[model samples]
Target: MQKLFKSSHNAAGALLVALGLCQATPVIASETWHWHGFVAQGLMRSADSNFVNNDGAISAELTEFGLNSTWKLSNTVRLAGQLMYLDGGNRFQQGGRIDYLFLNWTAINDMDWQLDLYAGRYKNNHWLYSATRDVAITRPLIVLPQSVYFDAFRDIAVGSDGLAVTSTHNLNFGELELNWSLGATPIPKEQSQRVISTFINGKTEQDFVHQFSVFLRPAQSKSQWGISLLDSDFNYRRVANDIFADGDFTVQRVMANWRYSEQDWELSSEVFQERVSVYGFYAPGTERTQFGWGAYLLGSYNLSAQSTLYLSHDHFFANKDDKRGYLLPQQSGGLIPAYFGYQRDTALGLSHNIQPNLRLKMEYHWNTGTGRLGPNVVPDTVVNRSRHHELWAVQLMYWF
Candidate 1:
C-alpha cells in the first residue's frame, strides 16, 4: 500500500510538471500561474531543558526556506505544491520535504454552495493554523503552543497522502463549512525514534488517519466556531535483536475551537481530549490505554500597521486522571519522573514588519513540566531533569 501511494504521488507530480512546461507556450502562458517563496532564520535557546539542544546553549538551528507555486489548469481545476527545507533542531526532522502537492478540483459550484476535492498530498485544514504553519510570517509566534501543535509530530500532523473534500454552504443564519480527509503519512526511522524512543530499533508505519471537521460563522458576527474529530492507527515492526516487541497504537481525538476578531484585537482558543491505546511495544502482551487532554488560549493585538503583540497560555496532560503527575513515577516503577505527565506554558510574543515583505518576531515562554518534550515513550531523564524551564526565540523572515 505504501509503495502504491508513493508511485501515485510521483505520477501526480510528474503530470503537474509536464503541465507547467506546456504552459510556457504563448497560447497557454496566459493561463494563471503564481509563484512565491520565503527564507527565514532564527536563534533559539532553552534554559534548564533540552528542548532545543542538550548542551543548553543558544542555537542557530532554526532555518526555513520554501517555494510554492499554483497553476490553474482550467477554471475548475488547479495544481498547487510547496517544497521546503527546514532545520528546527529538536523540533522535528531536518531535511527537505514536500509540504503539500495536490490537484484541486471544483466539484460543485453554485450561488449558495460550493464543493472542492483534493488528491495527492493534501494540506491539513482542520486546525486554525495547520494550513499555514509552514509559512513563518503566517504564524503568530516563533514557537506555537506545543499542547496541540507538538513540533515532534509536525510532518505527520501537517497533512496526509491521499484524498480530501471540502464544502461550503450558505444558510439564512450563517455560513457553514465542512471538511473530511482520509490518508496516511510515511514515517521515517529518525522521526519514529523522535516520537517513540531513541532506543527503538524498528520501523513505524502509520496505517491511516481519518478526520472530519465543521466550522460555522453566524451572520453579521465576527466570531467563528468549529469542531474537529480525528482517528488514526499505527504499527511498529521490530527487527532482529530489537529490545522492544512489535506494537500497535490507536488514537482518537475530539476538538472544539473558537475565534473572535475585531479591528485591532483577535482571540482564539482550542481544546481537545484524546484517547490512546497501546499494545506490546514495551514487552510481549503489554497493553495500556490512557486519556490525554490539551488546551490553549491566545490573544493578539495589532499595535500598529506593522506591529503585533501576542499572549497565550497552553496546557497538556498525558493522563487527565493524573494532572499533577503524582502517579507517573509510581506507575513507571520510579524510573519516570512526575514531570513527564504534564506541561503548562505562558507565552508573550511580538512581531514587527520591517517592510511589506520582511518581518521580525520574538517570543518568550515560561514553562512548567516536561510532558511535551521528545522521546515520549521513554522519558529522557538526564536532559529534562528540571520541572521549570524557559525558552526564547528571535527570527527574521523575508518573502516575495
Candidate 2:
C-alpha cells in the first residue's frame, strides 16, 4: 500500500515537471518583475523515523520543491519571497507557509558603510547561513537542522514584526554588521500533532510573543571571529478567562564562530546553546526549562579551480521538559523534568562547482537518538518516545 502511494506521488510530480517545462509564456510585462525558481526531484522511495505519523510506519517521500521570485522597484529596494513545500506523504501538511514577507530599504550605498532598514517579515540576522535567512536556491541542504524538529535555532516569530535596522562597515581590519529588531509571533491556538505539538491539534489558547536578537561578524575575507545572541519571551492571555500570565514562552541562546580565510581555503566552527521555558504545569501549571546545544566544523580544500573537497559535521542536544520560567520566583514545570531526550549527527560531504552558478554535493550522515526524561509518559501513538536509537542517510544535493 505504501509503495503504491509513493509511486503515484512520483508520477504526479513527473507530470507536473513535464508541464512546467513545457511552459513558454511570452515575456509579458508592463512593470519591472523578475522571477526564478528551481526543483530538486529524485526517485528516492526512502524511509525515515516518525514520532507522529499514522502507526509509525515508514514511507518513501519526495523531498524537494521550492520557488522564489523578486520584483525590482528600483535597485535599492525589492520585493521577494520563497515558496517551499514538502510532501512527507501525510506526515506533514500540504499547504506551505511563508519564510518572510517584507519591504527592504537600502539607505546607504557608500564604499565604507551601508544601512538597511526593513519593515514586515524578514530573517533574524543570527548566523552567517541560517536555515531560512538565505535564499533556498543557495542553501546547502534541502532541509536545515535549525528549523525542523526544533524551533529555537530558527525561530519563526524571530522575524521582524515592526521594524529593523542593519548596518555594515568595511575597515582595514575586516567588515562589521550590527543588527537590531523588534517583532512578535503568533502563539498557536492550534497546531498539527503530525509535527511536534504541545497540546492536541486544536487551539488551546491564542496570543503573540515578543522577540529580540543580535549578531556580529568580523569578515569572511579576513581571519576573524564573531558572536550571536538572542533573547525572546512570551506572555499569553487566556482566551476563555481573559487571565494573563508571564513567561509562557521564552528562550536565550549564544553562539560563537571563528574562521580563517585566504586565497585558497577556509576553516570554521560554530557552537551554541539554548534554554527554553514553556508555561504549563506538570506541577500545578508551573513552567519548565530545556537545554539545547550543538557544534559543527566545516573545512574545504581546493582540488582544482572548479572542484573542492569539503567535510562538514554537526551534532545537537535537546532537553525538552525543562520549564523553569525566566520571570521571578522560578518554578519547574516538573512533568518528568524532560520529556524529550537528544539527537546527535555528523555529515561528511563534498561539493564541486560545475560552473559559477551551479554546484553539487554528495554526503553521508550518521544519526542517533536518546531516551526520554520524565514519568507517567503518555506515548503519543507514534514512535515509542522512550527509546534510544540510531540511523543513517546518504544525500545528494545541488543548487544554483
Candidate 3:
C-alpha cells in the first residue's frame, strides 16, 4: 500500500508538471497590463526520518503555482500583485493564498539615479534570494539553505503588508542600491507552533506581527556585496487556553552577502547572526535571550548553456555558545538531546534547462544534527535522534 501511494503521488506530480508546461503562457500584455506566472512540482524522499511529512516515503507535497500581474497606470506609478498556492508539507499552509499585493511608485528616475516607493503587501527582497525563492526555477536548490531560509517561517518571511522604499545609484565603478520595508502581517497557526508550543498541542493567533528589513548592495566589476538587517515583533495569543501562555517575541537578524559571477562560474557566500528575545512566555516576569549564527558558501559552474552544477555547505547553531548542545540535556532533564541544538548540511545540485520555459533540478543533501528540524512536522524528538540523515529531491518547473 505504501509503495502504491508513493507511485500515485509521483504520477500526479508528473502530470501536473506536464500540464503546466503544455499550458504555460508567456508574459501577456494589453496596452498597459502585463502578466506572468509559473508552476512547479517536486518529489522528495529522506533516507531517515526528518521533519517533512511522511519522511521515509517519496512525497510530492512540495508544490508551487503563482500568477502575477502589473498594470502600468502611468510611467511612474503601477499596480502589482500575485496570487500563489504552495503545499510544502509542514513548511507552509496547504492550498492557495495571496502572496503579495502592492502599488509601486517611481518617485524619481534620472540618469544614474532612481528612487521607488511601494505600499501594500510586498515581497521581501532583502535576503539574497527571498524575493524569487518561491519560484523553483529562480532558486538554487529544491530547498534553500535551511539555516538562513528556514521553511517554518516561509509565509511570514516571504513578505509583509505595509510600506517600503528603494533607491539605486549607478556609479562610475558599478552600482549601489538600498531598500527598506516596514509593515505588519498575521502569523499562521503552524508557524507559531515551532516556538510557542514546543512540546504541547496548541494553536496560536497573532493579531499582527510587525516586521522591518533593510538591505544595501554595492556592486563593483563582476562582484556584488550586500548587508541586510531583519527584525520582527510578534504578539501571540494562545487559542482555547492551551498549555502555552500569551507573550511577545522579538527577533533581530543581521546578514552579509557577497557574490561574484563571470562567464560560466559563480561564487556566493552569506553569513548571519540572530538574536531572539522572549518576554512573559516561559513564565511570568521572566525574560530570556538566545543567540544563534550560521553561514553558507556556494559555488556553481555552468557546464553548458543549458545545464549547471552547484555545491554548497550550510551550517547553523541554535546557540552559538553551545555548539555541541552541552546544556540541553541538563536544562530539559534529559528529555531532549544535545544534538538538537545545531545542524550541518552539505548539498550537491544539478539543474538543466530542458526548454526556455521548462527546467528541472536533481539534488542531494547530507545533514548532520537535528537542531533546525521543525517540530510541527516531526513532533517526536525521538524520531530525530539519529542525528544523521539524507534527502534526495527532484523538481520540475515551468514558467513564462
> Candidate order by lDDT, highest to lowest?
1, 3, 2
RMSD of 1: 3.2
Please report, in order, the local distance difference test score of every candidate based on alpha carbons: 0.88, 0.47, 0.74
lDDT, candidate 3, 1-400, per-residue tens: 1111111224333433332221236466777777778889888887565556645778898788887777779999987766678887756668766566678999999998999998877778787888877667778888888898888777777777777888888876567788887776655565666534455455443333333334434444677788888777666555575555666677888898888888999988889998988776555666878899999998899999999999999999988999998888897788778888888999999999999889999999999987777762223475676889888889899887
Mind giving the per-residue lDDT tens digits that candidate 2 earns over 269-348? 77877776777522237766767676777676777897666566665655433222122113324332132344455555
**Top of the candidates by lDDT:** 1
Model 1: per-residue Cα lDDT at residue 308? 98
Tens digit of per-residue lDDT, candidate 1, span 37-148: 7889999999788789888999999998877777888999998887778898887789877778888999899998999999988999999989988889889998999989
- Tell me the TM-score of each prediction against the true structure: 0.95, 0.67, 0.88
Root-mean-square deviation of candidate 2? 9.5
Name the weakest run of 10 consecutive residues (lDDT summed) in model 3: 1-10
Q: Model 3: runs farther than 4 Å from truth?
A: 1-27, 194-220, 376-380
